[model samples]
Target: MRSVLDRGLALYRQGEDLPAEELAKCTALAVQLAERGERIAPLLHAWDVGCSVAVAACWVSARPGEQSELVSLTQWSSVGVKEITAAISLAYVHAQKQAGLDTSRRVLADLMLNGSATDELAAAAHHSPAKEYVAVAGRVVGENVPSAATVARASAALTTGDLGLSCQAGRHLCILAPIRSHRSTEELSGHMVETLKRVGITFAAPAGAVIAPRSELAMAVQQASRIESLAGIAGLDGKTVESSQVISELAISRDGEYRRQLISLIDPIVEAPELLKTLRTLYLMDLDRSRTARRLNVARRTLTYRLERIEQLTGINPVRTRGILAFVLALAARDLDLSSSVPEGV
Candidate 1:
């Protein structure tokens, strides 16, 4: 919430209009709060505080002999703040009517993913068959997981042109967004992260592949989910992992024998907990020796010794290109059993 306020203030300081995207984010947060049994008072209170802070910002930035314009500035700020507050209040009321649920969006998401969306539902949800789209799959973490409807509403607010659809399928949150540009997936995912943060919801989803046709959405979602799991195994959390970032590990994760062989490459270092930690930290830090040593809270000399020990045990240098890739893939393959991966048309 503080971050949201700060972001709003930053935009104001820069003399920029509050984009529709930011307003949509506010609506999403209002829905979440109202769903959680919060009243409109807190939302208004936050807005009031924002108005005060924004006024203070204006005062500080006022030029010499501009005292006469302060009244004009205050009036303008008051109007803008009131409008934003009213919009958020209306969103709260709307959410209350649905008991803070987006049941329709959830149903629509399920139907689309299963290829069962009726023409009516597709039309209502604004899903276009001829449009290009992308799937972002994730698992909600932390104490407060936003409902699928809330996610869909938030995604829709951030989406341009036709709105996107989202739903929670078992443990995964699947969002289908129309591709507005090459960076549509990246921008939407980033907005989701920011909006959800205001209400304390986070996703452990990575970037998903683009879907040229609506028919492949389900498969792309499933594949994204699998990549998400792969990222988890590599100790990557939040939205930090991209599909492209883990392509190599994903490629070798399927073969049972090959996976075991890769895991074995690190098995020797695994027996020594310190050495294993060092190796993992090294990779996590992108093989930066100085940073890795500082993260491990060890002297550079000690860090070097651990790297040497890992090489002695695994017969692979940890610093070189081939060696680093091998170790990273090995670590990713560990505990990644995809035998029960999502089946087609599921």
Candidate 2:
């Protein structure tokens, strides 16, 4: 079994079309071995199936015009079983749509029932054919179907790859992407901490949160302790008190202070109070002055003047980092207090 897996991996590394086919064959053998009551590990079986599916997905994605043939081959081969079947059906539907097929409820139903109709399959089906599917899936899966405002917030976080913010916006349904840069983990973590604040996700980096390739579970616990110590110095409160925290109370407190300062700095420049109401709209629209002005039913020149006055009062450039930070803080603050004073318009 080990020899078969090694051979499969070697073939995959060859990176040729023939090698992909060979790998698929080996994966089938591995699956057969597992089903025959061999000592094959479930993880090994999973890997084999995943590799076969990935190779097939690559083939289809590379030659979209050949998707039908690929799908047929995958289905008949039973390479990745239900998963490959679903992929094939999804690819075919997408290809058909691109070719101007109607691709409505009928097509969706066909795809859903084509393979094992797991929850994901059903959810995908309902998304296309039925409005009620989303609500039902939301209830069953405990996924938060965020409001339009929350969607907007989540979209912004996704655009920037701000995982903590995305998770917060999506109500913990999102996972932060693993850091891939050459920067130290601590630095990357610090940046994540700051970004989470901007997006209003409260989390702590207890030792356990600082997982590394070589770090042991004990080391992780120690790291959590270090984070807790740091949090105490920062003067923050947390959802719970533990030796380890993913986010410290001090970080939350600092975020609150930063937000307050932002509002305090901006509140004096409101030559036109209505601009405050437009802040969220403007930020969502990516600070396009002309676009914001149009949305607010005001002239571009008037909008520019107000923005300039706001900059003068806040001493933060509307187009720069400080200004963007202030804008976000102000928006969050608005949600907390509608009757609060509008920042002075620049």
Candidate 3:
């Protein structure tokens, strides 16, 4: 959240409207936040603070001759202020929760996103949730995320037909759904899938775990994320992925030596977000250039340009079978290394 605030501040300081993609990310954050939290006053406050600071930035970025108009002393009219403030408020609200439980969610999100716990904060939230629950780690993405109220309605089946708490975990929405001890993993996965489908929310197949005690939430969440490597079990993308299946990918992902090597190899392309996304989609489309281009809605020439640039940057010809395998492995490593990586200072 602080990072999001900083980004808003930087954009505001530049006197630029928030980019549509960035706004969307913030909006998605808000939707997931809505899953467990109920209010967003703090987020609002943070945004307001960013806006206020951005206004002051005019004093610094403005040239001597342009100072009067940009600064406007007392400002005859509140011209751009209202629009900027509204944008900040709305976008921040989209990423915010209802009101309380901010700290609890923050701690949990940090642990899930980074894969380590903040002892003091985690301890406080630890005792609060159910003791025997299942952890579901996966993401829900798109322009129109379901409303918080709508998501709450869906949590019924997710929380073991009882209650569950879904919170933000980096790029994923990790839910700790409470379940009866007797419930089997198959029954649990079925319940989760049915609930999400009913809500009209299409999500990546989740990595799930039947958590024994509430205190081990951090570990459960980590295991859940790693389970995503179990691609064989996933009949489709938007289904639940269980831990019992991810033997190979999980094993390879755990090797720190290989992970770093892949990171180094992939970093050249991954460093460029657009290229990385293109490469990922291409890999998903089974290295079919025409299909990938169509999916990306780009012309064949443009796709070629991007792919050639990627090969140049990564020094690996993605057109080859070996190169394609490398691309796939690199992406998996990145998912494990950067996205849901071990927590900083862990």
Candidate 1 lDDT, 1-346, residue by residue in tens: 4445556556655777678878888889878876875544544656677668867876898899867767766776677666666566556656755793434444456556655445555554455644566676666764134564455555455344544666654566666766666665667566655655465556744434335467777777777676666666655555535677667667666466898888889888777889878988898888899999999999999999988888888889999999998987887776564344422332
Clashes of each: 0, 27, 8
Residue 76, model 3: Cα distance from true site in angstroms: 81
User: Candidate 2: minimum summed lDDT over ten consecutive residues — where?
Assistant: 131-140
> Which portions of model 3 miss their true places by more than 4 Å?
1-188, 195-222, 225-236, 244-249, 270-274, 305-309, 340-346
- The top-ranked prediction according to lDDT is 1
Q: Pick the winner on TM-score between candidates 1 and 2.
A: 1
lDDT of each: 0.65, 0.41, 0.57
Clashes of 2: 27
Question: Candidate 3 clashing pairs?
Answer: 30-94, 30-95, 38-98, 39-97, 39-98, 39-99, 40-97, 40-98
- State which candidate, 2 or 3, has the greater lDDT: 3
Question: What value of lDDT does candidate 3 attain over all alpha carbons?
Answer: 0.57
TM-score-better candidate, 1 vs 3: 1
lDDT, candidate 2, 1-346, per-residue tens: 2343345434434632333454445445534443342322233346446757655655756564766655555453454344443443444334444454322222332222222223453343233122111000000022334333333343354345423212211122221223455654445545544443476543432211344222132233234434443433433353223333324232323365664655565576545466565555567668887788888888888777766766776677766887786676554543433432111211
Candidate number with greatest TM-score = 1
- The CA lDDT at 232 in model 2 is 36
Question: For candidate 3, which ten residues in a row score worst on lDDT?
Answer: 112-121
58-158, model 3: which lDDT tens digit per residue? Answer: 56777868766655532421433334334443433334424442344433433333323233433444424444667776656461343444344444334
